[model samples]
Target: MIQTVNGKIDAKDLGITMCHEHFIIDLSKVRGEDDSTLQDTKLMLKEVEKLKALGCQAVVEVTANDMGRDVIKLREISKAAGLHIIASTGFYLAPYHPKWLQESTIEDLKALFKKEITEGIEGTGIKAGIIGEVATSKNKILQTEEKVLRAAARASKELDCAVSTHCDMGTMGNEQVELMLSEGAHPDKLILGHIDLVSDILYHKGILEKGVNLAFDTIGKTKYLTDEKRADHLFALLDAGYEDHLLLSQDVSRKSYLCSYGGKGYTAVLGYFIDLLKERGISKPQLDKMLIHNPARILDRAC
Candidate 1:
């Protein structure tokens, strides 16, 4: 079964899933930019409806607790949009880590993640469906970030939940994978996000060769890399027969990326990039594995 903001559902029902996204988040505190906040529920609803129209049935909301994760708002959006929204439980990069986190041990962080995943998030009775967006810094994993990653891995292993992670600028993915697996998290259950931005096929293959999953998630953010190049790298992976280890998403975190704000928004993957992949010779079955089968397999839990 796959846990969603609404409740558990059969994995087969999670069709055309976007593996990383954010809704009703407030990153202004950490980002220090007003545009970093996405608080307008009505605007978010409109964008989500566009995604629904594009055939995206679900989204793995990877907004971490310190990144202003509002599960109550996520529940409202899930109900209003009628999209299966899987909320996350974990801390983000070092800058977003809260003050209390510095004092917390790895075991303390693990217990917190387990409680949020199994019981409820902050007593709201809306449990998180995954443990993620837990992150590492660019080219390096900070000490505090290491603690969060270790704890996330432990919680994921114990609860049998997938742990999606942030690989800043797509760097340090190998390190992230090695650390998480060393902590006993299953490689298949670990999704390293933002990998598409790196533009390194060998780096991607290196992570996949380790038996972990890779989220080619930053699909439409052209400032980092073009969709054309993203497709090329993805095609290379598929050609190498790693389709089952990949996932796709736009990682649409900022309001500037939202259609309501004149950007590609949540529909970037299903609405545009899928066609790009097809044009680059990514077959229908390979697309299905990345979009439908792979996400369902990773997100499914014993519950």
Candidate 2:
């Protein structure tokens, strides 16, 4: 097995591990916070220290192929910061694409992602260690999205990398999973991000049955749903026996949408998620299982 300093995990392990969270994401022209790219290595180290203080041993920085996924920079900064930083390879949201989106194909996208995981990322000197935060191109999980996800799903299976996605707001995960499964990607290697918006236990349960990992990634963004509602749903999901297929995180990256009014923006997103679990009557031991044990299993598998 591909073991780490820790042991194993599914999605949840109360000694909780955050599966997808961004310390900083470089959206090129779309600016938020200060410039936290490679130039701000000290700041990055400081931030990782905070996560460590909170007991986060690792963080998967699933920045996309077209976005600010600087693998060389990520390795240097994460190493200095003493965090097990795992980077990913895949496409991003449509808006973030360059002018070449008009001509890209499944093979083209796959070749680029393969190069990153194999050769290197943009010749930056550090290679991508994982697969995604892969988002589909379709408005819903349709043909275009399916094409990208199919390539990504297949690539992940071949490379033994985990695949995650930036899902549409209204529970588009069902369609997303359809593509991954169709492409022979084991659902265990796929994480459906943004499922908190699904709002139906039966809907999520059905999706979980397909065996893809579930990501409760938007934990601290309480404006859309109350903290109570988010916690209740999450706790209920844990109780629903899908624990092995879950991933916990605060998708606390700056995208103008989440930055209108905030402190350091991503700061305290982890803390907020942790506190909500406490308020919901979830004990510390259980929290560790969801956050810690399960995530380890998901990442270290098939090594």
Candidate 3:
């Protein structure tokens, strides 16, 4: 299991957590730039150390099958960086991927994912740290796409890792969650990531009603709606009485892992969010529940 940045790990120990963020993700999109994609541990450690010092106890590094998710490297880097690392399993953006058609069934992909977790990923006896931060394109949900998600849901049910996904522009979260629920996945084990990009309050509420975790964190990118708005959304969700179901994070990564992102990455998401919340008048206990108790529970973790 990957350790937390501050060395306190366990479901309950993932305090002030960010549910789904990438530590270092280099997709095939960065193909033929192998040297550029490979991360330098010493440099990455600087960021990790900063996060640890800043109070980022844990982060779920969700680099999927196609999106440059590296369990071994993440484990090694996290250990050196002194952070507890949680890794994601599964594939990326089904519509954008050609392999979407290759799998005859999501069950097949589930088998592969299960094998990875149960047996080992890439020959490392270490299983995936989490089920997935799976993805699909905007309004382009295909038949197989639903199937793969359902399979992932089943796998998450079987394996006990948190299952999450990226949402499309509008109404996708609602559709996606319905699909997963139809397939027998527990709503409690699900995380609806990327709600910021998805623009619909009704859609967000609809998904939240399904008992799935609604993560409305897209901070650190000033170009985003604004911390005030992000705060508004978080509090609105909380005020709407869903605070227990929310999670937060920036999704930032070290520049080398991602060719883009000027690397204005977080040494500590917990530190940043706390400051933002306080400036916005959020109480200490309220903030604590959102970042600490809530995330631990949502991870379906008793630890």
Candidate 4:
């Protein structure tokens, strides 16, 4: 079963999921920017409704605990938008980690993550479905960040949940995979995010060689990379027979990325990019693997 904000459900029911996203979060603690906060439920629901129209039934909200995770708010948003929202449980990068986290042992961190997954987050009865967006720095995983990643991996192994991660500027994918695997995370259950920002097919191939999934998330965030370039790189992977190992999402966390705030909204990948892929001669089966089957493979937990 895949745990969602509403409760455990069959993994096959998590239809057309965006593997990485954020909603009802405040990143001001780490970003030092007020615009990073996505607090308006009314506005968020309008954007989510657009995604639903494009057949987005679920979204994995990967906002970590240190990044202003609000389970109650997530539940409210999922119910209001009629989307199956998966909450996450883990620390992010070192900077986002709480001062107390710096002192906690790996076992301490593991227990907390397990509690959130098996019990409930903060006594709210809202369990986290996934074990990440656990992250590292640009070039290396900090000692603190490594501890959290290991703990998250251990927790995921115990709970049979998937693990997602934030790859800064698309760096350290290989190292992240090594660490998670060393800590007993199955490669198929691991997803490395923001890979589209790298633009290096070899860098992506290196990570894929480790048997992990790659999230071409951050779609429509043209300031970092264009969707055309993203599509080009994605086609290379599909051509190389890695379609089953790919996932898609927008990772829209800011007000500027939301349609209600004059941005593209959550429908960019399903609404716009899929059409771009078809124009590029991507067949229907390949598109289905990327959009539906790939996410299902990575996110479907054995119940």
lDDT of each residue in 193-261, candidate 4, tens digit only: 998899899999989999999999999999988899999999999989898899999999888888877
| Candidate 4 C-alpha error for residue 74, in Å | 1.2
Q: Give the Cα lDDT of each candidate.
A: 0.91, 0.66, 0.66, 0.88
Cα displacement (angstroms), candidate 4, residue 186, comes to: 0.6
Among these predictions, the greatest lDDT belongs to: 1
- The TM-score of predicted model 2 comes to 0.82
Clash pairs, candidate 4, are 1-303
Runs of candidate 3 exceeding 4 Å displacement: 1-9, 28-38, 95-101, 169-171, 253-263, 301-303
Residue 239 lDDT (model 3): 72
User: In candidate 3, what are the lDDT values of residues 98-126, reduced to their tens digit?
Assistant: 55456567778888778876666787666
Each model's number of backbone clashes? 0, 27, 8, 1
lDDT of 1 by residue, 127-174 (tens): 899998999988999989999999999998998899999999999999
Query: What's each prediction's TM-score?
Result: 0.98, 0.82, 0.85, 0.97
Give the range where candidate 3 is weakest over 10 consecutive residues by summed lDDT. 1-10
Could you give the C-alpha RMSD of every candidate to the true structure, in order shown? 0.8, 4.3, 3.6, 1.1
Q: Residue 10 error for model 1, in Å? A: 0.7
Name the lDDT value of residue 147 in candidate 4.
Answer: 94
Clashing pairs in 1: none
